[model samples]
Target: MTNLSQNSDIADDEYLSAFYRCAYGHLATVVGTGHQPSRTVEIGSGRGLARLSGHSWWHSDVLPSEALTLRNSAERLPFHDQSLDALILKDTWHHIPDIEAFLDEAHRVLRVGGTIAVFDPYWGILARFVYRFLHQERWDTRTPQWSFPSTDPWDSNQALTYMMLRRDREDFHRRWGDRFVLTEYQRHIGPSFLLSGGVSRRTAVSGAWLKRLLSWEERRGPWFDHFRFFHVFGLVKQ
Candidate 1:
C-alpha cells in the first residue's frame, strides 16, 4: 500500500487531490452528519478523513505514527465491545490479511446501530485493467476465500472490496448479513485520475480545472460508469 502523505494537503496532482478529497468528504459525511454517533474511528490515518470531517475522529493505523490515536491492525481492534459508534476505512481495507477476522472485530466494537464506511477500489473496466496490468497489487476476482496469506501490511488484493460487496456478495451475506446491513453504496469515476498518474507522476490539470473535470464525470454518470475506480459503501450494524 502506498503511504499517502499523512497531511491532507500532500503534494498530489490536482486530479488525484480531487479524487481523494471527494472520498474523504464522502467518508466524513457517512461517519458524521448525524448518520452515526460522535465516537467515530478512521482506521487508516495516512491522509485521514479526520482533516475533512467537522466532527472529531479518533485516528488509527497499523503504521507506527506518533500521530495515530491507535496503532493496530484491523483484525484486532483494542476498543471495548460496543464502545464505538462508527468505523471508517479508506484504502486500508483491501490490505487486511483476514477479511472475516476484521469484520468480526468490527462487529464486536461497533454499537448495534453503528455505521461502517468504506472507501476503496471498485472493479470497473478501467480500474480492472489498470490495477491488474499496470498497478503492482494483485486483483484476483476468482479467489474463493476472503482470507489471503500476507505478512506485510502493504500486501493486498485490490479486488477484495469488489469481491465481498459485489461478486461474492451472496457469500458475504450468508456469513455476516444477519449482523450488518448494507445501507449505502455508490460508484465513482476517475478517468482524469488516469492521467494524473496517481502519486507517481502527473499529467492532468489541477485546482479549478480538475474540479471541473470531476464535476463533469459526476454529471455524465452512466456514460463514465464503466471507468469508475472507487466506491463509497456504508454498512450498519444490526
Candidate 2:
C-alpha cells in the first residue's frame, strides 16, 4: 500500500482499536466473573480487530504469539471439546461458508455455560440499500446460498458479504437455544463516509465535514434502526 498522509495509519488503527475496545467492554458486561471460561478464542482475528485479552486465552488468524493462537478455518477449530470459556467472532459470521457446522463445533467445544459472541451486519432497510448500492457485493438476506468451499476460503464471489444478517434474535435462538443462553444485543453505526479502502494522497486530509456528516447520519432518525446496521449478540452454553 502507498504511504498515507500523517496519522492516517493511526486513524485506521484507532478505528479498529475502538471496535475491539467496545466489543470487549460489552462482552465483559454480560460475562460475569466466574461466568468467563478458562479459555477465550477469536475465530477470525484478522488484522486484530478484536485484540487478545489478558483475562483469558487469546487467539487470532494473524499475529501469532505465545499468548495468541491462529486457526485457518472456522468450520474446524483446532481445540478439544468443552475447552473454552468464550469465543468471539467479531464481524465474521457472514464470511463463514458453513455457519451451521461452525456453530455446532462452537457448541461442542464450549464448556457448559461458555459464551459465543457474534458481531455482524443486520440487513435492515438502511443496511440493505447501502450494501447493495454503496459496495460491490450484493446483500443477501439468506444464509449460505452462495457456494463457499472449505479449503480455499477467499474463493467466494461475494468477497465482502456484508449483507448476510441473521434475520432476528429468535432465529438464532431457535438454533442454539438448547445449547446456549442468549445474553445481550446491541447496535452500532460507523464511520459511514470512510467506507473501506486504503487511504490515498487525494483523500489523505481528513475533513471535519465528513466526520460531521457521519455524526448526523448516526442520529439521522429512528428509521435508521430498520436498516442493516451493526449488531452484537452473545450466547452462553447451556
Candidate 3:
C-alpha cells in the first residue's frame, strides 16, 4: 500500500485521483442542491473543493498557506457582522478547541437565513472500530463533553461531531436555539470513505467501482443509517 500525504500532489496517482473525485462528487451535490450562497467561506479548507462546484468561496485555515485566502481560527472570524451568506466546514469542527465559540463566530458573520453546512465523520459501529484501530485519532464517545482539553488549534477528539449531533443532539438544539436552526441531518456514505483511503492512505477501490458504490449508496443509504460513517448537516442562522 502507498502512503499519500495531504501536502503532496494527488492528481498523478490513479487511486488517489479517483478517491478525491468520488469524495468531491458528494460535496458538489451538497453545494448544488442544499445551499448555494452567493458569498461563502470554507473554514479549514485544505485544497478546497468549492471551486470544483463553480462556487465563489474564500478559503481560510488556522495555518498560513499560499493556497488559502486567509489565515484565521474558526473561533474568531475576521469577517464583519452578517457579511457572509454561508459557512462550510468539512471535516473541520472536530478539530476546533471550542465549538461553541466557533458557532458564535459563524452566527455573527452569517446573515439571518444564512446556512452553515458541515460534512464530517459519523461515529457508527464500523466507523468507531476504524477510528479506534486503524486511524491515528481519538474516538472516545464517552468523553464527558464535546470540547477536548487542548489549547492547540489542531488538537482534536474525532468523536465530538458524532456526540453533539447524534448522542447529545437535544442538548445542541437547546443551547443554540436562539442563534441557529438545524435544517437537515442525515447519515451518508457508509463504506465508501474506507475504500477511498482518504488523503493519507492507498486507495482500495477503482474510480469506476467507487462511482458504482456511490450510486448504490444513494439508493439504500437510509436503510442502513445506523451503520453509515458520515453525517451531512445544514443549519440556518436565526
Candidate 4:
C-alpha cells in the first residue's frame, strides 16, 4: 500500500501533473455549464484545484493543512442554510461515515439550483483489481450498502461510490430525486494516472505524451464504459 503522505509529492510530479490537469480540466468544464454560484466550497481539498482556479469558494478538509482554508466534517458542513451556490466533493464521498447525513447537509447548505459535483474512483473490474492488490484503501466489492459501518470518518470503502451510483443507481434516484437533480454521470479512464504510478511509485509517463493520450481518450468517450476506472457525477439542488 502506498503512503498517503506521498500525495503532496505526487501532485507535483510532471507525469501526475498531466493527469491532474486533465482531471481538473474536465471537472471545470462540467461545473462551468452549471449555475455560476457566488459562493462554492470543495471538501477534501487535496491539491486545492478549485481554489487555484480563482473560484469564489473555500477549500476544506477534516485535518488542518497549509492547502486548506477550513477544517470540518462532511456530515456537518460549516455553512449557513441556502448560502452556497455549489459544493465539490472530489475523491471524498467514500471516506464519509454517513452518506445520508453528508447529502442532507449539502442539500441544506446549497441554495436553490445550486450544484454538487463529485469525482471519484469507480469500482469496475479493472478498478477492483487495481485497488484491491495495488492500493492501500479497502476495496470490498461484496459490501451490501453504501454507508460505512464504522464511526471513523477516515475509514473508507472505496467501492461505495460504484455501489451507490452504478450498482444501485435506481435506488439512489428513487430516494433523492425530489431534493436533487442528477445532471450528469460519466465513466472515464485515466491511463495517465495509472502510468504515473499514483502517489507512491516512480512515474512511467511524460507530461506531453500523457496529455496526448488524454486527448485521444476524450475523443473516444464511448469506450470509457469498457475501461472505466473513475467517474464524475453532477447534481443540482431542487
Candidate 5:
C-alpha cells in the first residue's frame, strides 16, 4: 500500500544499505576468496548503496557521461571475457527478462575464479501470503506483462512462475555445471511480518531513538527470524 517510488527518504537508503551489507557479507563468505575483491561490479546498481562505496571500487551505472565507466544491461554485460573478480545483483534477478541469458552473460564476463552473487526474493510461505493478500505484487506463478510505471498486478494469470526458494538450488548447480559452482543457497531474513504484513516504507519509523532501539532489539535475536523476507544464492565461475 505504501508507494515506495514516492517515499524517497534517507531511511529508505539506510534500509537498502543494511540489506546490501547483509548481501555482501554472505557473498564474501561464498566466494571464499579471503581477500576483498579488488575489482567488482554489480548489475542494477539503482541508487548505489549496493556499490559498497568506501569499502571497494565503486562505479556508477553506465551513462553517456565521461565520469561513468560501466554501462550495459544484465542480459548482455559489456565487459570483456573473464574480466571481473566479483559480480553482485541485489533485488534485480526477478526483473530480468531472461534468466538463462543473464546467467550466460555472467558466466562469460566472469573470470575463471570470479564469483556471482544474487540476493533475490525467496517467495516462501511468508512472502507468498503477504504478496497475495496485502500487497500488489504479482505472485511468483505469473509472467510479467506490464512493464514499469505500474504497480504489481497481483493478477491470477500466472503461467511460468519462478519460485526462487521453493525449488532446489541444485537445479541451478546442474544447469551451470562446472562452469559455475553454487556455493550457497541461504534463506537470510528468516521469517517475520515480511510475509504477513505488507513491507511498507513505514515499517521502520525514522528517528534517532527508534534506530537505537531497533539495533538493540536485533542483538536480542527474537524468535521471528524464521520468516525473514530475503533469500540469496552465491556462485563462483569456474
Candidate 6:
C-alpha cells in the first residue's frame, strides 16, 4: 500500500497505525487540552508519536534514536525540579524497573499541576489473560515491591500499572498522594491492539474495519473491569 511505512521504528501496518493514532489522540487531549504544556516530554516514546505531531512535545527514552529529542532514564529525569509542564508515556510505563523511582523523578521534574498521561496495557479480565499468556512481557501481580530485577531495560511487568493504580492504590497514595493525583482513568481498547499485532507483528486488518471496532468500543466501553484491553490514565502533579 502507498501508505505503508518503511521505517522499522514506526508502525507499518494500517491497523496498528490507526490504533496508535486513536490512542495518541486521546493522550493529546489529556496532556494538551485545558492546559498548555510548554515543555511536554514523552518517555519511552519510541517513534510512534513523531508521525502525529500536530501539537508540540519532546520525545525521550533511555536509548538514543534519531526519533527521540532526548535520552535519559525515567528513574532519573535530567530536567531540573518543577521545570516541565507535562510528561507522557505510551506503552512504556510498564517497562519501568522501578515504578516508585520513576514516580519520584516524575514528581521532581513536573511543575505543580503538570500532567503525566499514559496509555498502557490494562489488567481487566480479558487483558490479564491476554497479557499473561498471549504477550511476551512479564505479568506478575504478586511482586512484593514496585521494583523488579532487570539488567535489560526492556524487562517489565505488564501488571505494574494495575498493581500501583488499582491493587495497591492505598500504598501509592500513602507514599506520594500529596505530590501527584490520579486525575483520569479510562480503561478501554478492544481487540484492535491484538488484531494489529502492534509494531512487532503484522495482521492484515483493513483500516475501515479497525475504525469500526474503535468506534464501537467508545460507545460501550464502561465494561472496563472485564473486557477491555488497554487503559489511558492521567496524573496531575499536586
> Which candidate leads in TM-score?
6
- What is the per-residue lDDT of model 6 for residues 18-46, given as tens digits with 9 covering 90 to 100? 66777887788777565554588889976
Ranking by TM-score: 6, 1, 4, 3, 2, 5
Regions of candidate 5 where Cα sits further than 4 Å from its true position: 1-8, 11-17, 32-38, 51-53, 58-69, 142-165, 168-171, 190-200, 203-225
lDDT of 3 by residue, 67-109 (tens): 5778899999999999887888878878988899999899999
lDDT of 4 by residue, 119-207 (tens): 88876666678888888778877878777787555679888877777788899989998999987777675565566566457665676
TM-score of each: 0.88, 0.68, 0.84, 0.85, 0.68, 0.90
lDDT of 4 at 161: 79
Every candidate's CA RMSD: 3.3, 5.7, 4.3, 4.1, 6.6, 3.1
lDDT for 107 in candidate 6 is: 89
The whole-model C-alpha lDDT of candidate 5 against the native structure comes to: 0.54
TM-score of candidate 5 against the unseen true structure: 0.68
lDDT of 5 by residue, 5-123 (tens): 33344335554344445566665565566434456776765555433433353333423322224666667887788877778776666666566677899889788878877776656
Cα lDDT, all candidates? 0.77, 0.56, 0.73, 0.73, 0.54, 0.78
What's model 1's lDDT at 168? 86
Clashes by residue pair, model 4: none
- The candidate with the higher lDDT, 3 or 5, is 3
Sort by lDDT, best first.
6, 1, 4, 3, 2, 5
- Between candidates 2 and 4, which one is better according to lDDT? 4
lDDT of 2 by residue, 1-238 (tens): 1122332343455333343455556556545565543487777655443333233435555324333456467778788999887887766676677777777888888888888877665555656566556654445545444335544443332322232224344555665678777667666555442342212222443444444444565565655666425666677888
- lDDT at position 50, candidate 2: 38
In model 5, the Cα lDDT at residue 173 comes to 51
Error of 6 at 40 (Å): 0.4
- For lDDT, the strongest prediction is 6
